[model samples]
Target: MALLKGWRYGVFISGIVGLIGLAIYPVVIDPMLHTDKYKEVQKHNRAGVNQEAIQPGNMKVWSDPFGRK
Candidate 1:
């Protein structure tokens, strides 16, 4: 009975560790490791919008919904 209980505890702790690893991997590890692909996707995702079209004025955010660029 004691040995069985110890294996259960070990399995539970290992599962918790695996969950924490999965959470950190995407946000931190993947970006640094695959920077070029990341940048390409980021640009593609922001296709229609101009981030700072007019720096000191009202045309800050512009978007054309129908166009990819």
Candidate 2:
């Protein structure tokens, strides 16, 4: 019974520490690692409305192919 109690206490402390680490990691670490991708996604979402007129991978995407430029 004493051994079981000690095991339970160990598990309980470990679980609390894991939760605290997870809570802090996102606020302190994830942003630094993921900011570029996050910003790119945001920029893409904002520019989605203009995509119809400017297809990707084309240098003269703004101008039509038939000498519109």
Candidate 3:
């Protein structure tokens, strides 16, 4: 009764704390620990060599034998 209720409460609190930690980690810890990958991606994006060409009226069609188009 009481013991089960206390255990549930503890688990709930722990889950909330874990979620908060996960939310904070990407915003704070990740940038501090790993900066090289982000910088490289940013530089690549700025270089303008990875852009994809999209033409008007160009649509991809997939063949499906089991279902409708």
Q: Which consecutive 10 residues in model 1 have the weakest lDDT in total?
A: 59-68
Would you list the clashing residue pairs of candidate 3? Answer: none
Candidate with better TM-score, 2 vs 3: 3
What's the TM for model 2?
0.43
> Model 1 off-target regions past 4 Å?
1-4, 45-53, 56-69
Task: Give per-residue lDDT, candidate 3, residue 21.
Answer: 100
TM-score, each model? 0.52, 0.43, 0.49
**lDDT of each candidate versus the true structure:** 0.74, 0.69, 0.68
Best by lDDT: 1
Candidate 1 displacement at residue 15 in angstroms: 0.2
Give candidate 3's error at residue 26 in angstroms.
Answer: 2.7
lDDT of 2: 0.69
Q: What is the lDDT of residue 57 in candidate 3?
A: 56
Off by over 4 Å in 3: 1-5, 48-69
Model 2 C-alpha lDDT per residue in residues 13-52, reported as the tens digit of each score: 8999999999999898886677776666766766746755
What C-alpha lDDT does candidate 3 achieve relative to the native structure? Answer: 0.68
Per-residue lDDT tens digits for candidate 3, residues 1-69, read 355467788998899999999999999999767877676776776575423344335555432223345
The residue-by-residue lDDT of candidate 1 on 1-69, one tens digit each, is 445367788898899999999999999889777877776787799888657854557644544433355
